[model samples]
Target: MANTKEIQNRIKSIKDTQKITNAMYMISSSKLKKARTDLENTEPYFYTLQVALARMLRHVPEMEHLYFDSREGIKEEDRRRGYLVITADKGMAGAYNHNVIKIAEQELAAHPNSELYVVGQVGRHYFAKKGVPIDIHFQYTAQNPSLHRARVIADKMLENYENGDIDEVYIIYTNMKSSVVVEPQMIQLLPMKRTDFAGVPADVFHEEITMEPSPKAVLDRIVPNCVMGYIYGALVESFCSEQNSRMMAMDSATKSAKEMLDDLNIKYNRARQAAITQEITEIAGGARAQRDRS
Candidate 1:
């Protein structure tokens, strides 16, 4: 058993660490709440955008647009692909970053010709160190998932698609199903199929509504906005998942620290009592010897 002083020092160190873990938990909780609120506030606008796009597709099933090009003529194996991967800027979040990176690695293995567009420092550095080529590393956007950031990403993707740099685009991100459940998911962003909009509420208007200029012209405007909304939604979901994971990890760490403190306190008390008992015995022995000598 260690001396009382050493035990006391250990207890103090553990207490300090516990304070840091508790603080991290509280911070993560706040971020999680704010992320969810922001997503809720913007959901209605995105829903409306989706409905409009769905209605347009229904109005003209044969509509051909650059965004809808399936590129079926190109071989799947040979077609150039782009993946927008969302990860965390920092990691203390248990397996959150690891899970995302694993999925991204699987995707790249399947699509050897794919280009990576990573949006977090963690993922960017990991892939860069592994010698995996990154087409774009969006800095500072991972921590702050704002509309402006989403718009910039969407525009860049659309420009690349228009230029035929990539035949297809996909987004890989983490989705928070609930506070306790998070899963990494991937969704196709380009070459959208009409069936993808099947979830949009059935057309409310039965009569033909004439688009001002032309259906194609209207679609051109709505498609990019709709794409931006999709990217924003992904960003928000991934951000929420990261926060929730961090909160859980910190909470667990704080609890473990508390347990250690409790065990150390018991040891400290025992050591203190043993020392006092030894001192009392020594004093009693000295008095008994003095009396015998006298």
Candidate 2:
């Protein structure tokens, strides 16, 4: 049995830890809220663009765009694939980064000749430590997913796709449906599929919509925006997922620490009670001995 002072210190330490975890939980909750709001604001425009692209694809069934075309059996350089992996810059968000990196590793195993573009410091460090080759290491974009960073990623991905450096590109990140529901997923970005656009259902709009100039011309303009939107959406979703996971993890930690503090308090009370009882016993013994001696 530990002394009262030791138990008191333990209680204090746990209480301090609980306070830290609670603060982290609140911060993560705020960040997740902001990220979700940003994502919601962009969804309307992103979905509209998808619908328009779907309509375009329906009208131009035989259209041949590089993004729409597959380069399967091209040269060695053209056969190479690229992976744009997004992860948090820091850890303590449970398995958020770990799950993404694990999926990315599985994808890499499938595409052995692929190039890696690591987006977060966590990923950069992880892949580097894992002895995987990294083509690009973006140290800051994972922490702050901005339009400028999205455009930069878009430009690089487009440039490589056009130059036949990479036949296809994929993005791996965590998808957040709710504060308690977050999972890692990988999405192919290049070689845009008909299904990639506006998520239109088959029964929704069978009627063909008119394209202003030419179907090819309109596709040329909208495809880049659609691709950028996809990348941006992934960034936003991954960020929200990170915050959500962090919030939940911190909340759990806070609860666990509180429970621990309670246990320590119980133990502290027991030890103090034992000490008080012993002192009382000693006083009673002294009083009896003195009375008998007198």
Best candidate, lDDT: 1
Off by over 4 Å in 2: 75-78, 195-214, 291-294
Please give the distance, in angstroms, between residue 239's alpha carbon in candidate 1 and its true position after superposition.
0.9
Write the residue-wise lDDT of candidate 2 on 209-255 in tens digits: 77768777888788888788888999989998888888888988988
Sliding window of 10 residues with minimal summed lDDT for model 1: 202-211
Model number with the top TM-score: 1
Q: After superposition, how far is residue 13 of candidate 1 from its true place, in Å?
A: 1.3
TM-score of each: 0.97, 0.91
- lDDT of all predictions: 0.92, 0.85
Total clashing residue pairs per candidate?
A: 0, 2
lDDT of 1 at 163: 94
